[model samples]
Target: MIRPLLLLAAASLLLGCAQQTLRGTGDLGVVVERATGSVQIIETSHQTRLARIDGLGDLSHASVVFSRDQRYAYVFGRDGGLTKVDLLKQRIDRRVIQGGNSIGGAISQDGALIAVGNYEPGGVKVFDSKTLELVADIPATPLADGSRNSRVVGVIDAPGRRFIYSLFDTDETWLLDFSQGNTPKITRFKNVGKQPYDALLTPDGRYYVAGLFGEDGMAKIDLWHTRRGVERILDGYGRGEQKLPVYKMPHLEGWTVAGNQTFVPAVGQHRVLVMDSQTWKQTDAIDVAGQPIFVMARPDARQIWVNFAHPDNHQVQVIDSETHEIIATLEPGPAVLHMEFTARGDQLWLSVRDGNEVQVWDPYQLKLLKRLPAESPSGIFFSSRAHETGL
Candidate 1:
């Protein structure tokens, strides 16, 4: 029938499309789960199928982060282990098996090192990117619970060689100094906020801001002086007679920094909060759909795209960055969780979680160009700026 013919034609075109795997450029990797254990890697440029890293056993595919050099992608497999994937080889470089649940991690700028977080034990492990060797396991003690119930959630490196920051499931933040080399002088402290979910350090390392969930707010940690780490809280909501509950269940999910400003997606609040990084002051908040989970911005800093977790109709809403206006809405069918754009900001690639496929969209024309199916593609990472060079 025409349906089979149409699929055949689409397949032929995708097979013929060649993706230039340019190393070390602005590219995105969506670390997604197929079923319970498998992880698929999809190239955003030309919608080419690059590789698949598998063999995990009933493990949860939590998060995926690319090295600063864009050479190796570190995949934190919930129950499996930490997987190091070679970008060039399009294969698994090595898999280091660790006991606790694989929460997630972030890579250093040099790409020579990586930190993997274990949710159960509330510990993080630094590893060798090249040899897949385990370097040091900086065990974190949960603040309130003396119990291992606290989880290491978001992990990002500070500017320069100053500190390593990771937000715990609870309200604690761990700051590790790597300039001292192998043994990083660790300074662990509590973020002056409730339910610290994720944190981002400004490009200049002037501020370390964390998104709060238990309370409707965010915490800004002044890291200008490593010795004197200061923090300020920003209220994100107002309590009405109906009690909208301004700071109640404020789940700050995805965030991005542009110049001296910071944009955060308050998932539970269903709004985006803009703040001044230097002064740690609230600027304005743009409203979006309810349950806005995954938020991202284009490389050009022109638009901010947010993805909702609604099962009935999952979509990506494009908001003008400068104007703070809603511009476009893109639907990738059912169960769409995460999204990423090519370097040039021309094509937008999304993970259709329920469909078990990756949806490719043309941002300029606001069109759905193609859908590349990869079983349980929870994570999709690309190789450099191949797409930008093509256009």
Candidate 2:
């Protein structure tokens, strides 16, 4: 019995050494399997599925951000679970329940801190990226009339060691500055707009924009000049118009910039609003087939791709960034949730939730390149995204 036990130990040691030799690449990407609380890691260059890891908690609305080294992935689960996964090993390194309900998270510019926005207790929590230790707990303070805890969304890292988020109940936006110490210096801007659901920071980390759910415009904050306060842009752009019934609120994450123009989705309207980043004004509106959910620009910035809300989600439309005209519309099957481009924009991956597959397409040729199966997939994020700002 002693001899057999020694042989088993030797075999285990050899297996561990074999696993250590396996290496991961920055070109690899992950697709969320929301139904099973799992993610499938894939090699984007070859369009090959590598492995599927399960047991992640409540991934119904999961979002992922990577560390600066691109070796660790921080997955924010809707059930308030913050999981740190080692991409090289394809396993979870650490996990903790930081809140009652969570929306998403972001890693600091220096990669020392990870901040998550909560909905239940309603505030932001900052943690040590490496140790998963709590560093700060910022509660969204109540309003003058004593409203309930405001749901926090779009917590994004800024250039100056600061994080920005919006409070849904108070109708205000706050900047939590952690530059000096772990104790965040809170600065609040009042009357930004009603129900600012989600936000986006430009690639340069200069502008932070929030979409208003209760109004027709969006609130923009120039982080470069915080004293100017939150300025309203595209104010009442949809006023006095007969708008369609919106099945889902347009996602600000879908809004993107191409060349000199930033394309944004018009709420409850079947159109995409174009804004000039230089002039900070609404320049044009492109009519689409349905209510736009995601207006994303490919990595090359040569064309913009648009996806729609339910009932029209089966269609994907491509627009020429220069002419702002619809060039092609392809049927990518049902429940097309998200899209991601390769590092150089050579290949575009589309996640089809209902179809249970991810389809890769060649934009110029307007042809289907390949299709891979996924389980209720939503977001497709790559490790190369770590080097980009406001991912």
Candidate 3:
């Protein structure tokens, strides 16, 4: 809790606040797929190489978005640079240099606005999805002691709602309402759990879950009533306290919601943790490759793919959610980071962060479909099958 003294101090130092939102529609449908350094476009239907856009610069591609019309794709680099590509011509359209490396982002559901996270100052930049212009930039809450600055990590359009949720490094999450001038009032939570990494939502859009890195636990909270109190899961103890250890590195990536269940990887455990969406209890786990980053799931939740950062066995392990068994080991090599599936679920987009290329895989046969290149690729997203983002 904020002590009365600290509260009074914070109240006196309040400088100002800012919020902005836009209306109408947008152009281009963009999803930034990762390659260590190359811009890749995977075909939605077959995960085929639709095209490759490259030579971004010294900074690596971290987050990407395609224009609504599919004419342009914007790629964000780690050090605040943007590369605009022509999806049709498969060339450079334009680029914008913004804040810092993008941890995550949220595109307005209508495709009008785009918000990206900057790591250094933990700034959030709002952009015009069409012209790719900077609309507004909001700096994260500063620390009194002035530690390493905070960054916005993950962001998504709240399912069935107009509010946008953003996670930051400061152990806090903010709910931004687009209905009222796009200004998101920060809701402060004291015991939100340390190192809160990312959040996932249910298909029906009733629940929102945030992953906790410090503990073997995750905060499974109600979307609408999250502030009331959070439901706990796998909350084990460590040392002299109930503080659980997920892993020394944790490296909790994105989350996959399968049917009424949600699956997430414990990077260190090399296993997928199973949980019931309703109860939010970790039910079971199954073996997979080392350092499994993110999971891919279809609407039916029949097929699930778990990708890894294994140097030797860098492949996506396909599993049958029903049997909870690994059916296929789909490898798309040269060392990659996690997987991004196209909207249709036939193909997969894998980021080759070390190779500067994005690898596409066939979800069924464990075969390599094709390869696309980008500059120091990182985030992989499919707009049609868009989720909050594991990036």
Candidate 4:
């Protein structure tokens, strides 16, 4: 009887250990499953999945920003739903629908505020990151024809606890300063460019560059010296060439710097324009497979990966940053929506939407390593991004 009781106790202990739940920390990430409105938390180190949190409402175009501690994720959904998810518990702490439609979001430098860019009834909304309470609302009032709805994009946080964004309808750029108090001090720059599709801040949060859809060049702002105001760079970039009809606006998120050169995607063109970061002058152009959607660099800055817009979306082109030349072009499968590198950039994970799976690859070897099943995965974000500015 004594031996049987000891055996039963040991069995119970083993069962409890097997049922222990996993938490989000250390090399953790999430895959946005747009079709099902869920995010699958993954442990990238072990190539294992942790949990899928659903009911995130209309995530057809979703983006996530992690908290400072990396234990919480703030998901911005297409239907204007903002959800604060506890990565440790695999549950939502709070959620609110603050607008009619939203494009993306950003967290302030100090992680005290969150700002969301809107498409419908265009404007930007800010909320407290901790409490999810409304802090301020700034509408993108059209400067051209007095219209109210001006789609806002390229919303990002800079130093000094400020948020900056561009207006599509009015062709304007606005900066909101929140350092002084709860009331934001707004600064508007008019006629910066036509139809600013999207923008990106330099890694140091020094410059904000906006790509134009209605024109040939992009608008650049010197955040460190706002007195110089906004200037146009890469003017007439699409001149002389008969451009292919743009199916999807080339994403400026691909605007990245490798060494001293800034690589930018030319709208409707199958080339990436390279510029000197210091001079903002066009230095060269690299021809690619198709209209480039994203031009991301490896962590070590040794290679740059270029993904296309469509008709050629299945491919990824790798460029040697040192030589300024194309090294390899890989066909990772169909409808490759996004790619993310591991924290160390040793492994690259890509989402093949048509294949309904994510594939990991060795960037240096240019070889496929492993594949994991997913549900229409679009974006792959890791917690390490929390430490970077203008992410």
Candidate 2: regions farther than 4 A off: 1-24, 143-147
What's the residue-level lDDT of 238 in candidate 4? 84
Task: Give TM per candidate.
Answer: 0.81, 0.93, 0.75, 0.94
What is the per-residue lDDT of model 2 for residues 252-300, given as tens digits with 9 covering 90 to 100? 8768877688999999999999999877699999999999988899888
lDDT of 1 by residue, 238-298 (tens): 3331323333222232466655666776645567777775566778788876556666777
lDDT of 3 by residue, 249-307 (tens): 32343567777776887634667788786677778777777656667685457887776
lDDT of 4 by residue, 1-391 (tens): 9999999999998988867754447588889999999998887888878889999999887888888888888999999999998888888899999988999889998889999999977999999999999999998875457756799998888899999999998889999999997799999998898899899889888999999999999999999888889999999998999989887776676577877988888899999899998999999999999999888889888998989988999999998887879999999889898888887888898899888998889998999989999999988888887887776
Candidate 4 positional error at 164, Å: 0.6
Model 2: lowest-lDDT 10 consecutive positions = 141-150
Ranking by TM-score: 4, 2, 1, 3
Better of 1 and 4 by TM-score: 4
- lDDT score, candidate 3, position 363: 65
Report backbone clashes per prediction.
Answer: 13, 0, 32, 0
Best to worst by lDDT, what's the order? 2, 4, 1, 3
- lDDT at 132 for candidate 1? 68
Q: What lDDT does candidate 3 reach at residue 246?
A: 35
Q: lDDT of each model, Cα atoms only? A: 0.64, 0.89, 0.60, 0.89
Weakest lDDT window of 10 consecutive positions for candidate 1: 382-391
